[model samples]
Target: MRDLLGRPADTATLSVTDVDAVLGEVAATTGSGSASRRSELLSDLLSRATAGEQDFLLRLLTGELRQGALEGVMIEAIASATDVPADLVRRAVMFSGDLATTAAAAAAGGQEALLAFGLELGRPVRPMLASPADSLDQAVDGIAEPIVEYKMDGARIQVHRDGDEVHVYTRTLREITRHAAELADLVRGLPCTSVVLDGETLALTDDGRPRPFQETMARFGSTREEQVRALLLRPYFFDCLHLDGTDLLDVPLRSRREALHRVAGEHVIPGEMAPADAAALLESSLDAGHEGVMVKDPDTPYAAGRRGRAWLKVKPSHTLDLVVLAAEWGHGRRTGYLSNLHLGARDPDGGEPIMVGKTFKGLTDELLAWQTRRFPELERGSDDWTVHLRPELVVEIELDGAQTSTRYPGGVALRFARVVRYRPDKDPAEADTIEDVRAMLRG
Candidate 1:
């Protein structure tokens, strides 16, 4: 930033037009031999910028502008400004996959324009997400008619097929059709001429057990055909959003399941319609080396981009009594507290605690205030961002599982770890050992 600032130019103010011009020039130099020219343009813009303008420009360039205008807020704003219903605007955004386009439609043609934004071929729609359930019983009981399916620990994929031309997208709507040619071929071979499917895909072992998540991610990230062929991804589709010429987004889960079964056939994920069968499916999913089951309400429509009670994910979490080795200062709402904790496992050989993972989840405001006051009292040393503790404070952590990691001395790290509660009654010596953490990876 210092180098970019260089020397200030004699400019009173910088306009949006000036910044847009510089950005346009930078983007235009993408295919040309203009490295020095692009740098010169950026430097000039920075030199002409005021302190506030420079900060805004840097944040915009780095995609860190944290203005409170989230999607929901924007949707409401668009509806109020255009005199359209907020629900209509939100649905348009979800189907169109772009807020700007939805806003333009609302402004240009109002309700009629927004209503026309239906599911489009080759365009990905936002995925429906599930809320975390405490237990299978709770998930089953909460729904009127529950449909249980295995929740695979893999990358979420949205596949669209328009005849032989198939497109595959990640959960974020980024198209990876070229990299996932095999997936495209698989979708193309389906019976439907035009279809949209949402599912999870992962690599499998020789015995058909799912591979580690990292291995599945490697294939998704790679463009090499050899690597993609070697670690072929197997997709287990759970929902069919559009089948043939009909859109199923507004349809109930039961009807959607029928469409999915007819189209995806054997690729349809194993599921049962009865709430009584949820327990058996969960046990079978776990025994098959998969994650727990997703309990879904069979009567609810597919609510894209919503984490409502229509779908609930239940996983058998593993808890471990771990030690807090250090903590970093929080940000935003937790600004003054030592929010993020560096967790460690006890070493059985009388050595220092082995650093495993860190977490800031499940901490209530009361706990945050208590940690801010208590962690400093046990502080042995300090740094700019973290306060090192004396390894005497034991915290109970609940996690999904453990994965192999090279970042820590223990060679394993906790996954989806959150604070269950502080084990103030337990001693650090009685904490879980590093060997016990490694056993999760082996299991």
Candidate 2:
């Protein structure tokens, strides 16, 4: 193996398992450890690995595998590998909450194993998502009747409770229980035992109106008790995924919503059967300080992790809310400030945001100062010219239009993109999708 790299063979061949073991050891080491120690550890592992193993290990460690395979690709691969129906496999993943585990079970135990997958208490099932609707009428165009609920701009939360023990997860499946003890306490007081709830959590002002999205995020991201105590969150559960040993994932939205009402009581999100006027309901939601209304079909089963037309989100503007991926250093009077912002659209397949365009317009001196101060805090890595961020901040962008572009990962670029405002209330998950941006190209 070493001969291929023009190096003399020095050690025995290493199996894939051996490489994994080394990676585990490296991952366990603290960042505070000496650089020499890390180098020595890697050297030892490399000495025992074959050339092919060494090459693969380096790429894995450097995150340059570039396999170009995402969950969607894996689902297709699993379907092909296990001879299982693709939709069945997708549905299993939706329930099981892990594609890798579902694929393994399907390969080992076949269709029965896939069918056996169900909602488990304390495991967060992916929240069902909504597709964007251009207008209220477009949203309710086909369905006989739909339920329109206020789409509050806030964090997506999935609360799982079994008896006295409770766990809270974000839409991305990150456990935030330690940070949301107040929310857990509220869940504990619920009527049912062993339940899974899907909801939105946000802070409210003293007058009982929703607070600014930034204030909600400050409390959501806080780890200190004082910070959390200062801003108590209220969870408005919209759907019940599981309750009292019964899984409601495959059940119609109407039944699940009934379960939500029974479990969450008054805390359930406010909604009514297609009100006499969908437009009025949308305006009411907006006037009540919400982003929009989610018009959902009651008979449709929850399609977790998938955005479908069964549920439609109606908002006022056609603007895309994107994440700030990176920013270049400013020039002239704006010197030392991070000026040109690199914007990206959310990938629908649950991957990193795809870079769409760069914009330097629509900035006031105040915004520039804020970006200069905040960009450093969100920095992932940086070169002399630009600073890359963690893709945590979502910004609303007003674009002249989008055009086909081979330069961007989404195969499209924004024309004359300008920042509308920073969306402190929305997560990257709620950002406008690549499909949403591309759809604008044709219009």
Candidate 3:
């Protein structure tokens, strides 16, 4: 792990293409073992290995490691080792299982195969980063830099496709493939012989308005995939990392967008033309009741697993009343209050509340005590201070839209999530919907 994640813990100092080189090297060295043999042997060894799993894994291969090894960094390394671009590596890790497979393909088959693998997942792995977009004036000042369109409230979806197979992973990279078949079918129809796309799926309400992002999430939680088809969820394509037989990352965002448009066609996210006047697009997206536009520099292509100014999502921020369904034990001063709360939205069709995100801030002492005494009631079971609840109550929580998660049940998770109030009068059915959450994306 040290070899993979050690250097320049400061992401600012790292090159966008570094990780891809590392992955290419490792995959090339894995030899010509069969996938089944590799899986069996690795799984067994992993089951018995004693050196902190990640540590041993990295030692077996030549790469860096660190305690909070950011996914983006590892992704870069994998792409580097495989001679593939960061985007393809990012997509593979995000939507598929076993990084070794991606590495092997990139090593032996090269970037085109990696692109094909990433596109196999229903939605391409989304490349995300903490937004660095400046205000409208700041954005306008950099007009010569070139920018692309981006929507606000949609869920960040990673689609992977392989031959006839498709999978939709949430932000956490969990396989919610079986749960989202309608979307799978839609993505399967893309014109590309093989492709992987990075984008968002927004929900439109019955009134023709975008709904909260939570509504879209609920649909993701449903075992019933068709629920979203009826709800009118529209996928807004933003970036393409893998094309028919090439990696777009080596190209520019302009090229990637062109490829994205060709494959997605009518399904391509609807947006205005450019040299897109940033001010005009800003006004257009916001005034349309959409969140805001993402301004992607046309000259830059996808920087897989890295967050740079290459793409910027813009929108006025908004919050919502989400529920607190689970509580994780706190650390330090919050050691006893159960600081980090696992939040959920009401399930309209009678399923467990789907997890949205976690927050340790925003709880009053009274509310914390209430939670301490009351939260256990919803527990399916408990382990020490932590309690896993049935996720029934509706708490008025708020936050920016969704992102991926590593520790949540539903694949996608939220950002800057906090509590505003509890909804005593509202039942789970009356609470926020996935569409509402998607609308927040545009905020």
Candidate 4:
């Protein structure tokens, strides 16, 4: 923008239509002719844009445009604009997997158009989500018959197969079929002619133990055949949304499990229906090197894109008292607060606290305010983003587990670490040592 518009003080002359046309041309330009054509289109766009327009374009292109409107707000706006129920629009967006498409459908034909959206083969539908539960008993307290399944700590996958052609997508609906050809081939070998299955995929060791989360994620980043073969991912499907030609979006859990069992066979995740021993199942899952268990209501329909109480995830969290080394300045709603704590484990050899990991989760408004005021008092030095503080404060941190990491001096990092509370009674010398944190990897 600076190259083309160079200190132009002229009033804004570009309209939305003008910018949209250039963007359309840029989107359509492809193959060997794309670079020069896209450059020309961008040059033309900047020539007509004012300084303010150029600034807006830059932010929009770079995804730094931070208006206050979120997805929920946009759903409400769409409902109001189309004179349709918010629930209907949200459901449509969930199934269609595109908010813009849902809004256009609602505008074109109202409720009828929104209702027309269904589970389409080859098009990814938003996967259902589970809410966190403190314990297994609490998760199944009100439910009559709970279906508990092992919750794998891996990447979420939504696989769709239409005859021989198969496609796999991530939880965010990004197509990864090229990188997941082995998974696609396995889907093609399923008994059904066509299906949509929701599951998790992860790399495993020779003994079938799941690898670290980072190793599983590394398989998704490369397309080299040798690399893909070196770290093969195995799929463990838990839900069957579409089987053969019938759509099971509105099917109950019991019926969906039957379908999943019929088509998935050995690929199905291990679970028991209305287990008399839910706690035993959870223990077995953890013992098998899996995450935890997902307790689900048997009668509830699969509600995609919604984190309702129909499904609840229970995992035993491990907590440790660690020293606070530093903190980073917060952003957005936490603009002035000192958030994102730099957690460190005490060195048994009496050296400086060894950095393990950092976290900003589980902090309330009161905690944020207290940290902002308190950290500055103990600050030893400062940088543009981080405030280095004296290792005088100890905080209790809850984590899922620890993994081997080369990023920190401790050689291990916390996974899903969150603040439990500040340990005012514990001295820094009494904090959990780096050896204690690394012990999680052994188990």
For all candidates in order, the CA lDDT equals 0.88, 0.83, 0.63, 0.89
| Local accuracy of candidate 4 as per-residue lDDT tens digits, 40-98 | 88877876677767776876776865555788789999999999999899889889998
Which ranges of candidate 3 are over 4 A from the true structure?
Answer: 1-126, 143-145, 160-165, 224-229, 272-276, 317-329, 332-358, 361-398, 401-415, 418-443
Per-model TM-score, in order, reads: 0.86, 0.66, 0.52, 0.87
In TM-score terms, candidate 2 sits at 0.66
Segments of candidate 4 deviating more than 4 angstroms: 1-60, 65-70, 224-227
lDDT of 1 by residue, 1-443 (tens): 44676655556578888788889889888656588878888998998887767767777787766554778889899999999999899889889889999998999999999999989999999888899988888888856678999988889999999888899999999998877777898999999899999999989888899888878878867977778778988999999999999999998889999999999999988788884667889999989888899989989887666657799999987999999999999865577889999999999998999999999999999999999999989999998889999999999999989888889988888999999999989999999999999888723
- The candidate with the higher lDDT, 1 or 3, is 1
Looking at model 2, the pairs that clash are: none
Q: Supply every candidate's count of residue pairs whose N, Cα or C atoms clash at under 3 angstroms.
A: 0, 0, 79, 0
Candidate 4 has a TM-score of 0.87
Candidate 3 structure, TM-score to reference:
0.52
Model 3 error, position 85 (Å): 14
lDDT of 3 by residue, 1-443 (tens): 33233222222322325434534444555556655554554444334434444344555454332244566666678777776788667666644555667767777887777666533335444355435454755544554655546465667776766666777766666666666676788888776666677677767876656676667777767755467566656677666777666766568777777787888887776564454466777777667656677665677645444455655656565566666667887643445665578777655566767776778767887777787777777888778766887756777765656654446665556777777777888767777765455444432
Which regions in candidate 2 have their CA more than 4 angstroms from the true location?
A: 1-59, 62-67, 318-443
305 Cα displacement, candidate 4 (Å): 2.6
Error of 1 at 237 (Å): 0.8
In candidate 1, how many clashes are counted?
0
lDDT of 3 at 358: 75
**lDDT score of residue 158 within candidate 4:** 96
Could you give the candidate ranking by lDDT, starting with the highest? 4, 1, 2, 3
